[model samples]
Target: MKIQHFTNQLHLLKEDESTTRKGAFIVLSAICLVGCLTFVSLAVDIGYINLVKTRMQNAVDAAALAAAQEITNAVNTAPVGTADVTQYSRDQARIAAKDVASLNDVFIDKQIDVIFGRRSFNESTQEFDVTWNASPSNVVKVIARRDNNDTSAQDGKLKLFFAGVTGDRYSTIVAQAVAYVESRDIVVVHDFSRSMNFDSYFNNESSARLSDSQIEQNLELVWNDLQMPNTGSLAFTPQYLTTTKSDYGVSATVTFKYDDLEVTSAGEIEKVQVKYTDNSYQTFNGLSGNSVNINGSKNIETAWVTARGPSENEPVTVTNNGISVTYAANRKSATMSSPQRIRELYVGFTDNSTDYRSYGSNGPYNASYSSWKEMDYMYLEVLDGRSYWYYFNAPNGGNEVTLQFDDSNWEVKQAFGLTGSYPYPRGSWDGFINHARNYSEFSSRGFRETYGGLTLMNYILRDYPGHWETPDLWKTRHFPFHAIKEGHLLLCDFLEDLGFDDHLGMVSYDTSHRQEKTMYDSDPNVPSVNISSEPITDNYQAIRDLMQYKQAAHYSYATNMGGGLEDGIQMILDNSRAGARRTILLMTDGNTNTMDSGASSSLPHGWDWDELFDYDGDGNSDYYTNSSQRRYVLRTAYDAVQNGITVHTMSVGIDADRNLMRAIAHLAGGHFIDVPGGASVADMESEVEQAFHRIASFVPPAKLMNQD
Candidate 1:
């Protein structure tokens, strides 16, 4: 029994040992499997995280770049409130990111934030920033921030991979970029019109109806005056008198006259004498008559008597039926002349009617009233050592007119005339000098008051005496006063006065729009004025075709003026060559259409009076030809370009096409602006100042250093 028990125990021990070894092997296999799976998961997750991080980084970068680019384009194209460039930029970023993701076989999710800083005048020192966010699944999150700290600064950040494992994870990436706002050398062309002047009547008080202080500060009144009537007499003369004969023989007439006639005189003259003729042959010797009566007889020949006065030089002879007699001349005869002759000798006076009186000697006339009160008419004469005239009137019923004088008593008129005037001097001398000083001091000062150091340019029309008398006179005599002659000389002598000779060259003439003529119609002395390369039977039809071609040609070849295809080409070329960074501004009425046809691509319709020769039907047809307009544009452009000039063009009250203006701006790499309506003389001056400011900001100070 003992031996069997010992053997069983040994068998049990062997079985126990086998079980233990099997359990140990299973435990080791389970441990190895868990370890291997954990390693594999880590590797895959880390790789994906890195890939996501790179994609997010790229997305952020792209988004930022796109936004920046859009900003630049917006500066060139759209107005402030109307710029929708952000949306387009975001779309571009998404497209780029999507493409990249598709190539990488990874899903990407992105969010962009475009933040715009307040656009202040001092953009350089001010902070302007934009931030963009990019997030991708299992990848990184990137945040890109850009600020106008140092535009040239390169600053960016990137964060890779998520921290949490298994369930959820999060990561962050940061980046920054800095780009400078490109400084542009700009020239702004602006238009001035009646609309700019608040639709005031031309050459009327309404034209310059602003207050004195307002005028003084806001406007550089170039001129103002009365618009005189086309028909009126400056002086008057009397008609000549002659004698006549009658059937009665020697009739004598009585005459009454005064030695002196006064304007205030209301007294009447008394009759002196009368005479008659009869055939009875009766003579009355001593008849000093005060009043006279006439007598007649039947079958009687009449004879007239002659009065006698004192005869110092010669004796008077009276003839009746061939009888002659002499009498002494008297004082009454010496003083007396024929009363009818004396009455007929009166000369007509000036029409000093209440409604028609001159405003200023050279200004627009005030014809608002019908009848003249003594005070209503302006006087060329002075009274009591003062130049006085009516200053105000009641348009309603009051016949009374307020008188103004240039004496101490007339001080009130100055107050009445100069009310609500603008306040400020034109501008700093440095500022004006910086802008080439081509503008008037008054204009500069007015602009400074209204717009604070802004630059502007004014283009006034030249109308000979009318201009000199009206707006010009008003300007000189009133607000921002300047002499008309001096102003004219300043404009005419721009080259010598403003030192623009280096940049602005003489214009060249090329390309005639004239058409070929037939042998029978051709005249060497008088070339064909029509714009045609070849003659056609239908004159109108040929002209139409040529016009279309000319417009097309202008679009293709003459679209640009002073600049190249790139930006600031004109400024760069001109500034470098001329050693001065000055802008050229042109003010015109836009009435010239120099194309083959009297039409423009830029305007709604293209027929301008300045370009047409035969606008009126008066049979006279000498006027500007179609070629003149084109020639002007082309010549201006070519000269400006060749001389390295930045040309800015403005149209005032002209019917020019908008497209043409835009084209001109684009060609010159400049700005095209429309002046606002109801703009006072002050407003126009301010606008010019604004333009100058824009130009100054564009060109670097270094470029202006060499200019004297």
Candidate 2:
């Protein structure tokens, strides 16, 4: 009975304990289920909020960028020199931003916040600041957001998931951005050195234009005024003739004929050379002429005169020893021009000896020397002036030389040009020496204080550039300024592309852009022709006009980059618009230099002055070069920086002052353009145009700005 009672009590106690364990397990399982559901809700809500936030940021950035692009388009298409940042421009930008922002997916369509303002840099803080305004805005600010207070246009906050949420059921997100276009004012400065045309070539047409009288004028200027010293000279002794037929054919005589002059060709006899069958010949070089002594190893062989000029005029004639010369039958005219020559009478060339052209077989003859007495003459011939530098003027340069002819042979003297008994002071080139002589543009550059004698043409007729000016230099047509001018025009086109307000003006310099006097202010009896202009301007045509009809005519022919930069700076100070970025593009091709300004002018007074100056006009005075000139230039660059101008420098060739240009660019906060030299004019020109475009690209593009 006692054992049964104890077992029943124990079993009852075990049953109660088991029931308690079951209830506890149910409560713990329910809690774990609730915790897992809560974690999933948190993840979904957090991820959705993050995705919405990212989308919002992208929307605003894209909207701001789109708006900025709209403004840029307006600026580019509008006529240049118009009002900047107009209301219509800003309005269009805002519309673009709103349209771009609205397409984005938030909870719903959001109302974007758009604002216009001017953005500028703060010097004190070294940061950009935006000034909000209704007009003249350069910047656009955009804000994209969710959870707007205005329920009608709100992009509602992100909704919570997992069927329900207790508090704060939605999350708001926002993004913002700013973008702008820059306004700028720019100028181009030129280094107008004579050497600027050194590597240039005749790129213009030389055809029907030849028919026009302009051809003659062009020839004169190209062969004279803009002439550059390129060829060296050899010792020459001119041969004289007592009669037109004397002295030239001293041995075995040979006849000569010149190539015909044609509407299409500027032809002349390059040489009247005589050769023997052994190929031995008399060299008739400097100031070439007719009739040569062709005694071959003393054995007379076939001899002929070679007419040379343009390749179009090349023709060969063959004859045994005694050659009867005849001009080509086909000719433009048989007109004997003043100071006649063999080339002047025949108007065309011929290759067919059988069907040859003709016009006065032996060609234009100089006037008759039938008169008996001796007479003096002065024939302007282009002579290489280096040898006579110390003798003439000590070096303002030129090739237009006139000689005091004293060939005792009366016949020869009359055949050339010897009029009445006109007397120039009895001396060779200079009646007396001029210590400081004026020539061409250097009239005011140096004063003639001392006098002496310089016999430039004690002997007449010397060939310069070898072929004389008849047509050698004309055919080569090396005009570098043409390429330079084209480059300038392209820059103007780019300015047109930038839509006007960017503005452009130019000033050229060598010593100074100031043409206070005429280029060849050659006459001292008259007042110097004064030239001046506002430092800068937006008149595109005016700048182009200034460049037109110009070829390195600066007096002293020295480069003064600082003076040019100074002019540019003044242009900005005097003409640039407020809020416009002032900038300059400085171009050059030389070591920096200038003539001394302290020297005064005296001999430019009368014919007495004429007597004082050497015929070739290179007077005695020194060109000064020192560190001060360099400092002056650098100071100009620094002054540019002080006046809020940036100067980008370009050295046009291998020879340009790269260091100085680089220093100037660096000081004024700009770039240095390189000029890897080239062998052809086309290549050099292409580089110049490309450089202009490169700088054009520097006119700051529309960009995203930091909202901060």
Candidate 3:
């Protein structure tokens, strides 16, 4: 009985131990299960976070790029203050960032943390440096936040799926991006040859000439506001010598040994300026024996002065040659007719501004001025195979007019003929009138503009942003040059708006090449090409004026495309800034039919016309013909490529040497933007603009930069 009892106790103890083991195992299993689920949740949350991070990065990058583009557009549109530009850039950048962020769940925590700034290379550190709020705002920065740190940011929280369900959620992500704008320099080579006239625009089936009345009416369509200058200014058109400009190579040789030399005598007024109380002035030259004819241009005020011949008191002279000019006499008084009210008068030489008007708001100082010789003739006469002009005084009888010279009580009044110098030329100027009638037929294509109107200054006054002349008007006008002028002017406006760093230049080609001059003639009839080799300039207004008033050359009419390209290359080499991207835009409306005499030497060794026609054993093919004239043009393009210049080609009508242009573009690493060939004026202008805009397109809007 004792043995059996002991065995029972042992069995009980073993069973109890087994039960304890089973309980411990169950607890361990539970712990292991919990750990495995926790790990799985963490893994899911991490993957989601990474995915959100990637999305955030892409959003920020896109936002930065949009903002950067906005800055460039804002700058290229209108003239605004610097503060406005900065604010606009920032605003646009922020708006863009928010827009993109909304789609990508990337939001800004603070406005200051996001924006554009100057991103430039740091020479000292050999790395790019970022300056916040710096001008030029070439760089844009964007931020994406989802850390749930800032409530104002409204950053979207990430869903961790299974992880969130298990309360092991971790939703946070932040992304940043920086992007930058590019810089460049461009030159234009325009084929101003006569053949460009034959483009489809001018190659219309009808050759009917429109009447003057029709032209005036049509000209009126291009402008909205135009007020004529005071025509009652002077008694005579001052005739003088207009110094013609020579090519750059020649101009450089004729260096000015001296100009402002110390006058051995009391120094005649070689040139005198009148600082008018108002924004106006007059000018006079060639001072000999106390006599000089003077004329003035009207500005905001209306003041007329007319002196025919020498009188007892010839208005201005070197009386004392004192520190300032003083009128020898007091004020000169004048009586006016209705609507012919006197605004201001300037005695260009007599420095003492004290000589002013009376009973006219105490004209403490009316003004002082110097005379300028303006090309004011209606017709250009070629005498002895050279352009010449003859000036004669033929004052017409009219209502007695009083010219002014007033001071204190002494009103220096002189009676001069105030005849007709408006609407129509009225007077005893029979010589000029006869010459004008001689060319009244205006058959020459060169007389297209002058066939009717006086000047183009009245037409560019329109607020035309997208409107150019219609095809119907263009076809009826039969004016191809006019079409080009209209289109080129638009390009001028486009270039004018380009950032400050860009420089502009124009080269025209006919039988020769010319770096155009700034023309201010009412008729622009004189020789208008000179000042060769002018480096590209930022003065867009000056360039526009040159294109506006400069007339077609009657001397030579061949298209010397090679000359245009050579000079255009020179302009770039002489002026472009260091480290700036270089480009050449060649615009031609016809095939190249002419080249320079040195065409063979100008080309590369293997690229010369060819040895195919070498009668002599010499390497070069003897003579080049008109057929291969385009090859030389193509060769010049190759030269441009060797110099690292990007060459773009443009053509308007079917006559454009498209194949040659295409070849040139291919060889020189550029695009051949074919402006459709035809009478579509609006399309032509639009094409010209697009061509230039395309050149501008090379500048990337914004690109992502590595972040730290």
Candidate 4:
């Protein structure tokens, strides 16, 4: 009976232990399952938040960039310093930010804020700062925010899918971006002229051929010639004499020694002799001592003087010892030391400048025997049966010398005349006018065309950033390459570098004699070689070649500033080039000597030059009558401003019309770049380089100054 009772007790104890173990196992499994669920929820929520964060950040970045772009557009299209422009810029920025945000598929957002201001980086503190000034803000900042539990439509709140079971129902995300204006488009107008051939400023004779006396004056030589007191008569001893034949005629170079001794008493000059290398000689007689005239007077104590006869019947004289040596009227003579110098380099225009008259005679203030004679007078003679003007330089002494003709050392280059084709006589005012006329003729090709104008343009454009092996641009927004045609890749890259949209054209104008011949109205010969109104094109070389087509030799060399402005506007307004920032570069080196109003009677964009000038409406232009074409240019520029086109003007050499360029720039809201090519070759080249670089420089890509 006892053993059976003990077995039942053991079985009951085993049952109790089994029950405890099952309960503990169940509890542990429940805890593990809850922990796994919590972890899974956290992972899912965190991943969703990260995706939202990325989308928000991208949207904000796009919005900021858009705002910055809007600012650039405002700068390009709006009139500078106008309140309307600032306001429009702000509005555009806001609109752009919204549009970009939506396009980026950032619909579910709590709020987006776009702010415009000035942002700068502080190097000292290594931090960026923002200043609020919307009028002309350079920076655009955007912020996007989202928070959980808001549950509002498009609130950007993340709704948790699994975290809800863990009592976590919401999450928040926010993104911020800052962008600044980057890149700008600019156009440059350059002027080319004949004077540009000169190495230095106008009338710089430092580098020209000069005589010993001239060299002394320029400090290029020492004045070591023999000097004699005024106590005796002037005397000359010929040393070397030679003649050379040229296309013009025979020319002579004579070297002689001279003494400026005073003539105290009257003495007869027995004879005057001129000897040549060929054993030929000439003698003058019947000249009495009392008949001697010193300069313009026959007064006593007049040792030596150079004097010209009052008329053809008289003669120029140099007196010594009561004896006068005379050169017949129209004959020019000089006295000097050994080695005669070449005076004038090449004869140029000197009206209202020097005493050079049309008949090749010296006027007032030109001493007959001084250096002026060498500079102003050309010896006229017949040699080898041909007529020529002998280039002469005055000697450095007062001794009298007769003309000994030689033609051995004659040089056509030393003989004054045009250098190349388009021959115009030199040494006279008429020749200058003739040469100028030839330059104006369209068919005339000269150094100014091939080497001056075209060469400068080629150099500036060839080394331009566009032709670089790699496109120079910042990495941002990828430049929306899809907006450009495939054929325009290079052009787009260039325009991008220039801060332009690849909408560029050329408008060339030379004054035309025809009343109706004007820009656009007249046919631009070989239109295929001309640049047409178009969008960006990859063929930059082709455009450069087209620019070269307007060679300096082209017909119509007159500067018709109004006509150029006319065509320039038309090009900017062309239908194919619409939606681009319009700009024109009006460059010139001369006054507006030719112009035509055309039949339009109105300026571009419905403006009227007549309205600005013809206040009386008398059917004639009136305002700025002194500068009719100039007035018309300003009027056209006003129209350009109204039509949102910028016109930048460049003045080259001293002769360029600066007032006109300034007026155009002011009226069209563009900058004036005075390259001042007249300064020097180095200065002109440096200015050109700097000007192009300054115009091409653009604001860098907007930076994320501050982010959250």
Candidate 5:
């Protein structure tokens, strides 16, 4: 009976123990399942949250940059002093940020804050600060936030499955970013019109006139004004002839023909014709003649005489009875009761064959002299009457003389008026010496100063192999500045050596404005551009080609400073290049002669000239003077500064308005480089190139404020 009772109790105890074990197992399994679910939720949901946060950060960053860019665009496009906080909010930046922020399923709880203020980097503290609401805000900042309280961002809140069991429903996330407008896009406004031909020293075209005079003076110095004769002396011993009267009581008349004049090989007078009319005249060559009448003149005698020269080739011939030659002379002279009268004289050039080069055959005098070695300069006098002298330069001699004559009759012909200006001075020592001295000095000084800027620029930009051989010395010595002489520069080859990659563009203006080159192609409609609005490339060769071939426009003598500034500013007002700093290199070598017309109907987007600079209050076409142009430049610069565009001014020569350039630089918050007036064209080129380098090397002081 006891054994049976103990077994029943054991069985009951076993049943209770089984029940306790089952309950404990069930409780532990429930806890394990709950813990596993919590771990899975933490891994997957937390990963997703982290990813969302990354995307949100990117969105905010983009938002900040967009906002900053909008401010820049506003400043660039709006008229000077017209950009405000309202314009910033209305710009594409705010809209761009909002769109980007929503890309990652993150939405802002409220409108993004677009703040325009000053952003500065503190060197002492090594920190950046952005002060909000600063007047004339040049920096743009954007702040974006999201929480569950905002319906738009609530969908992106961290949703937890197991974490809810821990009494947590969702996790809130927020992201913020800031960006400051910086200047990067640059437009180099260069003067390439005809007037750039003006000198760096003087202000107007008067200098060019002086240059021309100097050229003429130098030419004279080289050829005409020499103190010493370039060619050998022309001095020659003269010969004399005396004709004695055979009959002292009777008077005699003489007639000399043009055919009898002769010259020796040494350019000395050798033979001359003499005639006398007298019964007592005696001839030296045994010839006798009665009273001769010439051209209706009675009582005329004739004789052919030879002067005593080194060569005794011919004998003297004279009429006999009335006159006799006591002694032979180069020129014939007669001692007669009646004085002799010269009716005419002739001069000509002879060929090597001693044949006359007739005036008809020889062409002009200078032409005849070039072909023939010998020329006869003749002189004649009518006793106690007017004397006449000339250089007879005729091809077939002259067809007619003072007396009836022909080319074949005589080699000599009377020359009437043959004096004129000469390429090289000749004749008297006074005129020749004066011109020769002046020409010599002028040649030493070199030719006229180079005037055309395009020509000079082409020389400066040429490639040279010698530059690389000694690169260090080339740069240190500023070789380009020193190497220019007579418009040639040895430093031209160094342009390729510079190897710079800065984005470059050009704007040329005179009476009108034209976009020469741009970082981005803005004019696709123009036939030259096949692709519309194509991004600018880094092709230095192409850039150089544009500069070399197409930089300068036609000569419009007018200078429109306001128009150029407006166009240059337009080049940097691009939204695609936002977040990059904008700059304008305004280089001018002259004053203003025209002004911008506030007409936007004929312009493209970003080409609103009136919006950029309004010189006259009338709001119509108005001409700007020097003073008004300066005001316009300053006003444009002010607008650029407010829009974060730095404008650097380079007054290449004296004519470039100095004070205006300084003011523009000051107001635009850009570096002012005075390549300062008074440099030669070559020197201006060197300094201008150096100024470009300075601008390229310049690092804008910390454009980003509080950058992380």
Candidate 6:
């Protein structure tokens, strides 16, 4: 019985052991499966988090950049000190950010916060700070952080898919930018003509009638406001004064005098005065006398002595005590005597009033009174309405005007002329008028007017910013390459503003004149050749030399054979290497006929006969002859263009050869412009500006690099 019980127990134990092993294996397998699932979950979750972070960062960056760009644009467009500019900037930033987000197909989960502040560097803190929360936040806290900062690593942030996995987690982004005031130095040149200075009829009687005091006052005002550098202070320098007169027969003279007088006794005194009987009187003072005489008799009296005269055909004579003294008139000469020693004498006779008139070498006669009046205390009159007269005391012996005889009881009064017409020469004034007319004609025909009213200095000033820094301020008798280099990039001035036209006129007028000449030369009947052609050879090359020289020539000419060609090519290459893409602006009148190299052509053979006849030949010519020289120019230009340069051509004038200009422009990958050639320089400058702006707009901003 005992043996049978033990065997049953062993069997049971074996079964129990097997059951335990199986249970353990099942538990282990369950643990492994669970661990694998957890690992997979973590990987998926992290990947989603990363994707959200990237999208948020990208959105923030785009928004920041857009906002910055908006600020820049608004600042550029708004006038200084305008209150609305800040608002406009904010609005632009909001719109730009919104647009950027929309383009990226992302939605901003939170409001964007934008803040603007002035950039400040704190020495004590050793940190740079920009004001934040200064502007209204539209999406998030737009913390403007420096690019160097760690916290601002991400420009902006958007909460996207990561919230589900990271428990509503958010990211921070900061934008960094630089802002500073930009300034450009400018030079301004203006014409300083009498007409520009004051409103006055051209040599009208009214203009001539202005008094010396009035003229002096007007001139002083103009001088004070002259806008010269270092003026208005006590240390200011006076400008050199020059005068030109209208009359050819009348001599021009200017005199400066200083007066020093003292009052001895306030009383009426008889004075002996000297007189020059021919020339106009200049001045007198109480210093020198031959003798004291009265009416050619020997006498001494307490008289006020006066001296005067550029006498009328007689010598200057002094009489005292029955004795007479005479002196010949000399240029820049004078005499003097004491005021109490001689009688006052007026060399030229005055009618009833103090006004003196020219008697035309006849006799003492009356003449028409001028509108100008002389002060009673003044010892001067306007003779012939042009010349001046003066009175002075002979006793002082110096050139001086004295106020010794003041009729103390006489009140200051103005003198006027009667309305009745006076005898006057009909055509005597015509000569003066004709001279004025001729002056206007010559001035108009000169380069000052012909080049669309552009002065050489004006062109330099307008075109170049660095021109002002040149040692000579770009002022040279001859065209200088230094000036051209200084101003070449200043083509901005030619752009158009709201009210200004383009600068096309400047190029047009010059080109048109050249075209006409070329056309005339091609004609067979016209003078075949001329000596003027000698200077015309290699003109274009000369121009290139002038543009590239260290000490450049003023006149533009063609380049010379070796160095000139090398220099021009190098210039273009250097500019390109430096990332300054060049755009050539060729202005022509469309007639491009030029001489063939080594061809047996006459002096003017390069000109177009057909065009010349068109200009003045009354439809006698059948076919139009083209310009070979112009074609050469075009080919040369095209070669440059094909080698990575762009060329734009403008044809001005009615006779512009559109076909040729269009072909050149097309080959060079540029547009052709046609406009009136006679436009003003200001207009031409505007046109050039416009073309540049147009070209610039099409170019990608990434290609632009600042050179200055």
lDDT scores for all predictions? 0.30, 0.48, 0.48, 0.43, 0.42, 0.32
lDDT of 1 at 403: 14
Q: Write the per-residue lDDT of candidate 1 for residues 1-708, one digit (tens) a residue.
A: 999999999999999999999999999999998777667666766686566556655555454344434433332344457444444434444444444433543333444333322111222543322221321000112244333243343222222233243443433334332222222222222221222232221223323454434433332332222222221111111011111111111223221111111111001112211222221333334434322332322211222323222223332222221111222121011111111111111111233332332333333211121222222111122121233321211111211111111111122112222122212222222332223222333332332111111121111211111221122222222211111112222322322221111122111111212112221212243223342232221133322222211111111112222112112233234333212344544433233323333432232134343433233556543332234454445344544555555555543322334444444554455566543313354454454344433432232221101111
Those runs of model 2 whose alpha carbons end farther than 4 Å from true positions after fitting are 1-178, 200-479, 515-538, 554-556, 595-626, 701-708
Model 6: how far residue 613 lies from native, Å:
33
Worst 10 residues of 2 by lDDT: 389-398
* Best-to-worst ranking by TM-score: 3, 2, 4, 5, 6, 1
The residue-by-residue lDDT of candidate 4 on 1-94, one tens digit each, is: 8999999999999999999999999999999999988898889888888888898899988888878877666544556566665667677778
Cα misplacement distance, residue 413 of candidate 3 (Å): 36
TM-scores for candidates 1 onward, in order: 0.28, 0.43, 0.45, 0.38, 0.35, 0.34
When summed lDDT is taken over every stretch of 10 residues in candidate 5, the lowest stretch is 409-418
Q: Which stretches of candidate 6 lie over 4 Å from their true place?
A: 1-34, 53-98, 102-569, 575-699, 702-708
Query: Alpha-carbon error at 169 in model 5, in Å?
Result: 40
How do the candidates rank by lDDT, highest first? 3, 2, 4, 5, 6, 1
Number of the predicted model whose TM-score against the real structure is largest:
3
Show the lowest summed lDDT stretch of 10 residues, model 4: 475-484
The digit string of per-residue lDDT tens for model 3 on 317-361 reads 211101122222221321121122223332222232322222242
TM-score of 2: 0.43
Give the distance in Å from residue 680's predicted Cα in candidate 6 to where it truly belongs: 7.4
State the RMSD for candidate 5: 22.8
Minimum summed lDDT over a 10-residue window in model 3 is located at 248-257
